[model samples]
Target: MLIIPAEKSLDWKNPPWMTLALMLACLVIFVFYQGKDPRLLHTAVQHYLDQGLDRLEAPIYETYLEREIRLEGEADRRTDLEAFRETVAAGERASLAVTMLMDRPFFDYLLANRDLLMNGRQRQYWTEARVPIQQNLINEISAYEAGLVPAEPSLYTLVSYQFLHGGWGHLIGNLVFLFLLGFTVEKALGPGRYLLAYLMCGVFSALIYTGFSWGSKIPLVGASGSISGLMGMYVAFFGMRRIRFFYFLGVYFNYFRAPALAILPVWIGKELYDYWAAGSTGIAYMAHAGGLVAGAGLILLLGKGWFQAREAFHEPEQEEQDRQFTHDYADAMEALARMDFTLARKRFEALWRDYPDRPVVLEHLYQLAKLRPDLAEYRQRTRELLNQYLKLQQPDNLLRTWQEYLELGEAIHPLEAEEHNRVLFAALRQDDLKVAEKAFARVRDTGHRELVREAGRLLADEFGKRRMEPKANEYRLLLKTL
Candidate 1:
């Protein structure tokens, strides 16, 4: 089953650069520093192959083989050991040697016996060879330092760990969640506080992970902890609002809207179930649960007006106004449907007066004007609606208004020069020379010197293409004067 949140209740005016930077930082670290380096593992494999098993110290070899038996089990260990012996007997080609060592079972065999391969009689020959392989196995020296190891907790790892990820899939999954929930949280908390809260949530998550996995050496990494916190905050802030979600269950697919907070318990409950049912599968479900608890608590405190002077609350005035507009707009549309022109006009006018900035209200007004063009008030309303469309800079509305103007035989005097140019260009593209000519003339009359010059040049080009030298020359003269 696949379930994902669709959209949030809030809108952001600007792009979230801080969140973007964090993602970029993770990518840079993974690609440039960790993934690109190939020295250690490759070198160690090459060295072991060149020296051969006869050079190996006996005591170290026996101890190493025992460790391999314990780790990989006897049957798998025997299989890999035989493969290594066969590769050695077959003239030990460098390519075949590297391949054998790279295989997981064979790699573990070589790692366990690294000390035997590097020391005593072969010390000079294998010193550099053994160093890289042993270090790579024991330390995960290049990459794992950035992750938070609960067994050996560090203050630095608590925050830096969130920026590190296990693999491309891990990074991508975390980034997707972060973008969905982070932007909304940033918008709600504001940027500075949002960054602080994100880091704090990561720290809290790590603490929870440490408590749960105190004896485990595996390092916890990724941004899921901080992102979980954002989800928790989302529930606290917009719990009552119905939010749409897209869900897929095998072949079945559908969308449903539910109260925002309703998903929180489901998420936490799933994590709890997974934690117990799956045993330790490497995922830090405890950290996710901890982040959720921390975020909900923090947001609740902020709601009580503790963190900042301003309390986080919904705008009742705006909500009420929206509700009223929806009610009135529907009534106006219903009146128009019944062909009660007088009643529709009055209702639309009331809507226009109350919601001057609403594009839908102006649209309905324009529709009403088309129905009763004989009325002076209706004609005037058409002009007002056209002007409003221009102000809004909506291309569809501008084109519709232009069509309505032509149909009504109204002079396009009030249309802005930019919109007039757009109409001219659109007409030219359609090869509607008559409409283009009319639009160009209207734009020329506006006395926008630059637009008039541009129109003259375009007309000149069109005429020249048609082999009308005289008309083209006339426009060229007009352009030169401009």
Candidate 2:
């Protein structure tokens, strides 16, 4: 009986997706109005990527004015100079060819699909790319104004460049995690608030990422920071829900769930451990930490209510009953543990009557029923308990429960085939021959064979009673094959 109470209804907060869309639209409009077309920026980026891709495939040009070194001769000096110049010329040609081949295709693709890949292109990209760039660009602009900047503005980027990825694997890995974590907090917090929360967390994560490598010129690409933020929020919003994770565990597809809160320590501890080890193998542990902190902090600030919501149990009556039952059960077990059978018997006797139908209570009663068999009242109560248990238990559970009773030195009921025959009859009547076979196999008596044979005869009679002449005649032909 799983009932979701009215109290469990989701908060009617702002929708994150709608808010993200609207906010992004305004940002784009602002950029557009300021003469900075997003399409142009995307095109520029695409061109840069295309240039890299072309260089990968382009043939390197090698030219040489043959320089045969004549030891101790004037030809050595003259030949070396010509060779050096040709080598330089060839390098220059190769660079130009790669750049030219890449620039056109990348820009052309961007121009053709700017609308598709820009605003409404990939909703995830906004969080992945734009948010990090916004923070870094803002910081760069601030530093530039203060005149406290390096002499040459770097074309090789750092934090802002982490959003750009080369291939489908690059984009998909980041996006999948982003959607998984982002969607959870987004749905919980609602759209509008969720967008702001996402962006804010992204910026915070970026600052942390950059803080570690303040002057790094290499481009760091991916939406990992934003995704980390969502993970942080996940811990805050849904602390203890079990999330099943998939990972290789010695070659078997082993399954397990981690409480959301417990998973945090694992992630944070791994990052911290790796950072301390100084394993600079390209993973930005700093960014993950930053995003984690931002996500956790932001959710705590904005969604303090989310934590409280989880603590709340909607069915007060059921919660009270369960709590009381637990306390009583624990006390009785403790008495049993202390070897005070008399006290345990008294406590179990009282609790058993209250929850006579409960499996745990009935089990306790059955265990005590043997020792106190002289108490005729207790013995009668045990019999009634067994009868009630058998009625509700499934076949497998019935078999197990009955055995448990028998093991307790309780009298076993006659193993009647009628009890099992009812299930067999129902299965056969529904034309479920597989279930009939399974059910019939469980019945103890050979007398049950009559019921099975009767069902088979009834099925055959039904086949004879079919109204369709073509089907009936087809059956006759099939009977000849049989």
How well does each candidate superpose onto the true structure, as a TM-score?
Answer: 0.55, 0.35
Question: For this target, which candidate reaches the highest TM-score against the unseen true structure?
Answer: 1
Error of 2 at 461 (Å): 55
* Candidate 2: segments with Cα more than 4 A from true spot: 1-167, 240-243, 248-253, 273-283, 305-482
lDDT of 2 by residue, 234-342 (tens): 7766567655554444555544566656666666676677766855455667777777788877766756553332322222344556898889999999998998888
Worst 10 residues of 2 by lDDT: 1-10
C-alpha RMSD (angstroms) for model 2: 19.1
Distance from true location, Cα of 114 in model 2, Å = 39
Best by lDDT: 1
